[model samples]
Target: MRSMPNTNTRNLHELSADIAAVVRDVVATGEDAVITDDGTEVAVIMSMADYDRLHLYAELADAARPGYAGATEFRAMSISEMLDVLGVHPTVDRGLRG
Candidate 1:
């Protein structure tokens, strides 16, 4: 599995103030950005190349797991389960997904 580079974290207010600069940094440096809200990490901004790479890896991992379902089916699960499958912490204060 390919590891991601160290991510730069910023609060939502900071990101709102300088979205362009943050975007440029992510695009040019290939390092992801973690967006936080009220001290809680909420989102990530990464280059398309990185997203594609991660998505491909996620697909491969899902396929290798026993009783794995198709991508379409996987997408239908609760956000918590999806995050769990993606190796993300389920307790994080993330936006909900149906």
Candidate 2:
């Protein structure tokens, strides 16, 4: 019943007022919704499919880096560590599961 992230950008207050409606729109669009706080991006809502694909890409990219390790080693790295290496903007809280 939650909205998928796509397209429109929403400030925290706007999202807080009607979270369901915003989520509904995102689900219908299968796109990204950028959520901001105080005019700064704070979160994003996106389809799970997109999320999974991104995770795979990240893992693969990690394998090619110097001091590269095997899948087991890469998998052992925390999401934050991976994200840090990928130079992704902070604020993400989820990561691929083993």
Candidate 3:
């Protein structure tokens, strides 16, 4: 008794020439593009399954971080610091490893 997922539509202009790069996002977001000629809509493209999946993920993300606006700052860390934070053992046996 699985219900069919809802589909979303988008305009052709919204799609990028390098869509393959963002195929995953496009599918998950339930977003797509409608090709148009002159003033008439020609075709529609989208990933119903992907859109539903992405939408659900987005809802979960929002629920997980309630009241969090968004990313504010971007910081770069050194390789040693990143490894330490991740508890990853450095492959290179550098005696001076952090």
Candidate 4:
């Protein structure tokens, strides 16, 4: 989320003690929490929306760069087409084809 842990930082023990509270805080704030172990960041807890946005951003950035495998074939396609290149077809994802 940030360069390093901020006020939202929480130790691993805090999670083991009461995960619900930590989760509630994250959802309420809509900001990820950095879960650390002995001052070292181990993981992050974030809302599903944030996680999805992160993945979409990553995919877009990865696809925009040259030599990304499908650049030539999908170069001029719309966003939906680019998604199909990644096998993430929104309209027919997860074998929902009919």
Candidate 5:
């Protein structure tokens, strides 16, 4: 979805009163409204799905980096060897497995 670029910056007190309206607009328009504190960017209001997707993508990106925890080490294995190690037998006649 295309998002509108309208952003609302506010102090803590004004933000408390209008946060609901800002969040509603973000959800309705699939956009993020920036919230600031003491002239520094503090938070953003966005659609839940968009936020989740961005968060998941960041996690995946981090997981894809070298030395990331729980990252799969596949450089030393052939496809057939990987499948065998994973206990997945290939039923089809494809050249690659796993």
Candidate 6:
């Protein structure tokens, strides 16, 4: 989904009166509709596809920052090794046998 710089504005009453129509327009054009109340923007409506794409972009950006990396690797390890990595002690017997 692409970013829509040009947005349409609808007053609260107008949105409430014909919500389906407004939402249809938004989905059809892929443009956001700003819902305003008392001349102040209160909310926005956009298509689910656009919202998901935007959310993914934000997640990627957050992961790109230092110390914000996500867990993308997996490996098998022993219980003791897992405990050591977690910085904790195993107080109960895990029933592991050699």
Candidate 3 on 31-52: residue-level lDDT in tens? Answer: 4544454545665455665345
- Model 2: how far residue 51 lies from native, Å: 0.9
When 2 and 3 are scored with lDDT, the better candidate is: 2
lDDT of each: 0.68, 0.66, 0.47, 0.66, 0.58, 0.64
TM-score of 2: 0.60
Candidate 6 C-alpha lDDT tens digits along 59-82: 554455456556566454543454
Model 2: how far residue 56 lies from native, Å = 1.0
**Candidate with more favorable, higher TM-score: 1 or 2:** 1
Across 1-98, the per-residue lDDT of candidate 5 in tens digits comes to: 12223455557657888778777777776556777677776667767775665456555555555786875663554434544544445453333211
Highest-TM-score candidate: 1
Candidate 2 structure lDDT: 0.66
Looking at model 2, the pairs that clash are: 3-23, 4-27, 5-31, 5-32, 5-33, 5-45, 6-31, 6-32, 6-33
Models 1 onward score TM values of: 0.63, 0.60, 0.27, 0.63, 0.57, 0.62
lDDT of 4 by residue, 1-98 (tens): 34632237889987888789888877876657888998888888887875786478557757666788755554455544555656563433243111
Model 2: how far residue 67 lies from native, Å: 1.6
How close to the true structure is residue 49 of candidate 4, measured as C-alpha lDDT? Answer: 73
Runs of candidate 1 with Cα error greater than 4 angstroms are 1-5, 69-98
Q: Which candidate order results from sorting by lDDT in descending order?
A: 1, 2, 4, 6, 5, 3
Report the Cα lDDT for residue 72, model 4: 54
State, as a TM-score between 0 and 1, how close model 3 is to the true structure: 0.27
When 1 and 5 are scored with TM-score, the better candidate is 1
Question: What's the best-to-worst order under TM-score?
Answer: 1, 4, 6, 2, 5, 3
Candidate 5 global lDDT: 0.58
Candidate 4 TM-score, true structure as reference:
0.63
Report the error of model 3 at residue 75, Å. Answer: 61
lDDT of 1 by residue, 2-89 (tens): 2234578878987778999999998877667888889877888988876775578567667866667543444345444555777776
